[model samples]
Target: MQRYLEGELGEEQFRPLRLQNGLYIQRKAPMLRIAVPYGLLSSQQLRKLASLTRDYDKGYAHVSTRQNFQLNWPELERVPDLLGELAEVDMHCIQTSGNCIRNTTTDQFAGVSPDEVVDPRPYCELIRQWSTLHPEFAFLPRKFKIAVCGSQSDRAAIYSHDIGLALQHDRQGNLGVQVLVGGGLGRTPVIGSEIESWLDIKHLLSYLEAVLRVYNQLGRRDNKYKARIKILVRAMGVDKFREAVHREWSKLKDGDNTLTEKRIEDVRAHFRAMPYEQLDATAEAALLAQHDDPIFKNWLKRNTRGHKVAGYRAVTVALKHRDLAPGDITADQLDHLAELADRFSFSEARTTHHQNMVLADVRERDLHDLWTALQKANLATANAGYLTDMICCPGGDFCSLANAKSIPVSDAIRDRFDDLDYLYDLGPIELNISGCMNACGHHHIGHIGILGVDKKGKEFFQVSLGGRQAESPKIGKILGPSFGASEIPEVIAKILERYVELRQEDELFIDTIHRVGIEPFKERVYG
Candidate 1:
């Protein structure tokens, strides 16, 4: 960094080095992406991040859909110092960028979810250790991403990753994984194909190595746009891709990369059970029933989820405030959230792929108090799983790659649909906006997807329908021609109106699209 700062390093030489360190030269300034390994962070780490934001950034940070945090306005020269500070808390930006393995993500509710089959964090950590600075995969054709889900619900959005692993148990009661390959979202959205129905957990690493080796060898290197593993898989066909992976696995399987029982147990030890209290379940119900405030009831129902433990709940700290960009939390909010985590959730919190934060182990009895604290901080939006709780990318405002600005579009939509009761009437909807085709916001999987496009150097927004991110994930279809930015909200309102007219009782927005097809929506929006 000193050499580059001193002008001793050329642009060609420093470009890859800075990217490897998670520094990106954006539209406005240099952005630093800090890896929050599998979205887990200690309260101390959160405080450290808050300090960095205050010192290096514009007093704020953005949470990404990949469950990472980004500092948007850091001085290029001071990024090294920021990273040094991160190191004190055992965090760094290694492999967060570049054509290498990025952070592996998983369910935010990994250990606490009532639906979990197993904790996926151990495997995520194992993969992190193996992939970090692994010489062989340092320069793949393009960036590679991995997601793991050990729960019945696919909260990790596994179907939209380079590699997706779903944990399952065999008939003989042995834990194993079902591997899916070629899944990705971008210019070409592809649902991952099941390459392996079941593989013993012991062979997890070895199998993953074989798959990477195959991609590293055969993935396109000539055309950057055609370089992702998904493109290669599509061109080769799933059968041939599976055969190629198997051939590679035959060579590397049962080798040193194979996981052992002791090795798995060792990593698992790092994520031991939290010290939970043995409070009665009925007591929790009674305590919750005491809250007469309808607003509190709405927040409790929308922003909190059931926990595996009897008297615990997973509280989602909504980052979707009208005053702030979606997924953005100020530095002060970071510090206060750290204190909240300490008091309520064992000094730990998890970032979700939905661009929200989760205090995974809050006692049911403390719900009202926690909500009050969060409300005061402007973090309790009561919009989780609603239209306003959308996943959006930092577009032309911050990203040079964007054709149009996304933040304004998101803000407009939020302002147009500010009524909580109206949002509840519409039910759960995934509205994702991307500045470009890169799909950083995972727009392709949103039930209502918006992509910013350039029309003769001017900005226009394109919409898609029927995309999903969870179980049975599907890519949304383009609704029609692009519309001006100012027209998006009215267009969306018309689409929702059609949904309301066509939907069956209790039907979701996506279900209505699927039932009657996108034609109805297109007609409504265009008419």
Candidate 2:
């Protein structure tokens, strides 16, 4: 029996006992989650993590939804030792695998986002320390996730996190956060219902503690699958939940744990902004003249986003593979990206939830050279946010939890729709694929949702339509019956062809679907 976790073992037989068949007895594996503060990491940190994975654990590390790295290896006995190594480099695996306070996540575009009111790094670092090794909330009913976004674009995907905090200012000009609770994904995915419209930053940690306490006491522990705080929030109405959280919050407010100005300043010191130089004009013109190719132009248009800087852009190296495994970057590919970040982007790389690597703070004119280098590295897939850029899980291929294989399905869809212009014409479509009912790929919120299911002995896919992820969040609706793997591409093609035919000029797929209704799409595809 796995008894050491419950404090029932001598230190001698530790490593061999804690991990039985790679299952760490909690969730799945003895996963080591490493924080990449604000999704920004030095190339050195990335290389070290890569080496750590290659040396200590599995050859691969999974980039989590919360912008952290989770390595699936090492013995539970060696966890303390692993923590010690991580601490040597100012990293830790504490609260990464437990029901206790987990790592706090923030927007990938924390500092550089053009739309941000202020950098959320200070807030994230402050909350991170408060949550780390929090004693009273160690044993909870279920896992909890928190995300903070300073951008209107919601780069952190705050709408779908367990506790989503959006930094905003009130009319009178005071900094505050708009908080959302209970949004989560798993067996049942839900957009978190809003609880607090505006709560000042000083009360952030205490308010969060109150909410967690309410959930810890009320959340269901009997059914592991139904134990998420979202279920609890839903079962007890939102208003009642808010009332309960307020009741708990009133007790914890301003009692020695109030966010002090000095404490905030201490955390801020650790996150001093990276040094940046003024853009060079001569370098910009030389870059443009060097690579005026059509492909490079498309890469420039789709892959690069506006940076807060005058002459720089944030480059997204999209891993939303046409048919390949999402978030699967080879070791060689990793090295190449690191080099690119060092040379072109100001020594920082960001890992996005869309499973893309971002080279933040790149000069606009140097885009062509960057593309040429990326092409060599196979990171130049000019489909950043397009339909071919499908967000897919390993499904049956790697994940033991999947009901069907998602890779092949994504591949089939990509192969059938190979024309880039046709994809561009379709415009701003989100196609998310999941192998099972568990929404790891976030199929529920995709413009075109594909869920792999088992019907009798054969695998099939069920399609959904009209979902979107911009400011106005809407869940997609199921289109119709399940189709065989072979039939998926044809069905998708039929739906898209119908969309192109019916859409007004410049109408996106999501807009066209919403304007024309799903019945037209369903009839065309199923007919």
Candidate 3:
């Protein structure tokens, strides 16, 4: 700290150091990102975050795409005090940014997803402990992201991360992980490639360490833009990267990091099964009410998702209300959410990468009352996975790296397509808007991506199509030419109109594009 004040450290050296502690000097104020490992938050931890936001910031915090909470405004000097407070809640902003092993993210419905192959939270928790303040890989070539998923569906969007771990079982029923490397979505977005189809859990940690060691040693550091592991993997190709990792792993095999059955069991014990209520004859009433009430049916269709526990459902509380920014939640609303989570979700809540919160253990019988409570609190808009449930960055409005305002574009799209029935017809279209090429909004993976660009110092938006963040993830393709800020919504409408006309019956927006290809859509838009 003294060396930094004495001008001994340059901006390049000090900037990354500060970012490692989650402190960023934004255009207007300093922003601090609080790590929420695996997106798990107890009611008490959430209340503490609420208090910190109210005291240090503008009474709100933004949930980021990495499943962390970001406080936008704080005095740089006072950041330590807030971090100290967060430490009291067993939380700290460590390795959230910078070239370090960042917070490990997982499926919001990790343990409880109906299609889960394994309970991934325990594994994620173990990784969180193993990597926290890890001495060796603290300052690597560039920032790294790792996501774990246990479900049949890729809710964690692991393919878009630097290291994606999808838990799987071999033919002999032994548990292992399918390892992927090189995936990212910044200036150069690329979906990760599989390096190991199924690595035994005992050797997984060592293999991961080997990969990181290889990347740390060989990844480009001279050019920050090309420093990411994705760049390295692309340059070397997946086969060569795999061989390097294999060579390194052979040296480290059966070393200290090798997993033991006792360690796995110990961590699993912490995540013991939730107390689930047995479904009685009353379960029939909940299903019947959906048929009778159109609003309830719509809400059920969008907000409530399947849970492994038969009598329960995972409920997504929409934070994309038109009145608020996509990821912003007021301190008061957070307090209320904590209270509601205590009552409904066993004192727990989880945040999604798409800026939504989930109550993962809500019983079906309590849906009506919970929905009513949510309605009063403005958390029950029922727009999960819809066109209006957009992923937006705090563009030129707050971020210094942004080219133009992104929230306004998100707001405009919401307003233009406000009809609920119309949104349902579109069917799970991901409309992500990034402020700049940084891809903070994950625009590269959206079905319909909008990037904020500057043309002669004027705000212009570039559009992309057919990108996805699933098992077979693909980067979006540009639609040629940029549009004025005011012209974006109309442009989106035209594309949607073309999609509606070209799509086969009940085909999804992305599926239709895959079948028809980008050229046809490009012709319709530019024709």
Candidate 4:
């Protein structure tokens, strides 16, 4: 795969082809990311991923925030062979790297989420085909990501994605999408500005083409760091960029770029809803009895969410435990998850943007048994939406791009806020940590954002306030001076302490911050 993407080797190659793709080799090994198109994988395909990790790489698979899989491995030369095997299963790493389009991500729960007015799988598939090895986009300055979220809840973390598409229904009940462009994390993480209010589903592809066309034509080429679509959007202003897109789209809207009925149907055929079984009442009662136990109950409450389908649930396995690298899992863990999926839960698992894993369709009756098995493996963490369940990136410790090491800070914060009750009481507070300005950790969208910076060879973290990640998105405002790693936990604790003191009952952290401004919390945290 590396050789193919690099144009270094072809199908009939030599020994020089036996090289790693520079995919971050660690003491743990090289992490190879597999692009899963549209977040949709059949049970058999998912099982193959589990088997691949179990056999060649580590024993677990890390589901990326981008709806792809990353296997931590050591053998670089084996990548091509591994990729070759993946190809047999109808998968490829074609656009997974380089300046081309990265993975096309969509809401993890797009089709199943009842709150969605329409399924976005078709649109995602269309974009996936159009962008795969797209000649014009292959040499863009930096990586690109596109996400579609049809659900009312922003499961895709649309605000932080490079190109965010929210499927919306017009007053006439016509399906369209609200397009947001240029928002990104990584250095200079910024929330994307909206370019189109409502675009008909038919013009979706053409509209996207128009936006990319404008970006491709005008985006900065001198600096790799400043070349993202966000920079272009920011420079031109959303109105001006929209106008440019409108002018370009006018030429292409009714042309071949438009989504055709046949094309839509062909893509839709691949994304047909999975066959589900009727809810089992006995199983539900039994699981409820088992969950009556305190620990099991806690796991159920924290890690499990209600599924639209009866007798099933969306189970999150939190990877936010202290001392464990956030988003890192072993190949053995992947095998176990696959086995669990095959036996007790649905024959499937999901990866969330929050750096967590999900057993998407666990039978209610098997919840306790599943939890028990997971607990044995240290995989069952009851902190999914809590303060401890932080979204973090592989900061300076791994990435050459990082300004500071974020893992240590995350560990320190988790250690200080280990109390489950306190976390539950706080309710859905997001503490996003990014190692650098790239904002891969989505510092801009966190309720309490932490961005790492390098100042005179020392690490400092900048705190931002009032960022929210739901339907109405808002970027965070920077607080005062950056704090050292050691001071982060205390600063975060003090800030939360103020929120507790000032907030009304059931008011979320973001709401309170918005209402009170950062003064009270700033004084408390900095004092």
TM-scores across all candidates?
Answer: 0.99, 0.89, 0.96, 0.90
> Could you tell me how far off, in angstroms, the CA of residue 63 lies in candidate 1 after the best superposition?
0.4
Over 1-527, each residue of candidate 4 has an lDDT whose tens digit, in order, gives 56555777774452222211225444445656787777656556777786787777756666666767777663766776777788877876566656667787776666666677778878888898888767777667667788888888887767776789999999999888999898887667777778777988889888888888888888888999889888888999889988999999889999987887888888889767667788776778675875567878888888887777777777887777764678877656666676777776557666667877777777787788898888877899898877888888878776677889998998888888888888989988888888888787888888889999999999999999988877577888888999999999988888888998999989988899989999898788766
Report the lDDT tens digits of candidate 1 across residue range 1-527: 89988999999999899888899999989999999889999999999999999999999999998899999999988887898899999999998999999999999999999999999999999999999999999999999999999999999999989999999999999999999999999888999989899999999998999899999999999999999999989999999998998899999899998899999999999999899999999989999999999999999999999999999999999999988899999999999999999999999998999999999999999999999999889999999999999999999999999999999999999989999999999999999999999989888999999999998999999999999987678999999999999999999999989999999999998888888999988888887
| Model 1 stretches with alpha carbons more than 4 Å out | none
Could you arrange the candidates by lDDT from highest to lowest? Answer: 1, 3, 4, 2
Q: How many clashes does each candidate structure show, in the order listed?
A: 0, 0, 0, 15
What range of 10 consecutive residues in model 2 has the weakest lDDT sum? Answer: 17-26
| Better-scoring candidate (lDDT), 1 or 4 | 1
Candidate 3 C-alpha lDDT tens digits along 333-413: 899999999999999999989988999998887887788888888999878998999999989988988999999999998
Please give the lDDT score for candidate 4: 0.78
TM-score, ranked from best to worst: 1, 3, 4, 2
The candidate that achieves the highest TM-score relative to the unseen native structure = 1
Candidate 3 residue spans exceeding 4 A from truth: 1-14, 281-292
Global lDDT of each candidate: 0.94, 0.77, 0.89, 0.78
Q: Candidate 4 vs. truth: CA RMSD?
A: 3.8
Relative to the true structure, candidate 3 reaches a TM of 0.96
Best by lDDT: 1
Q: How much is the lDDT of residue 329 in candidate 4?
A: 70
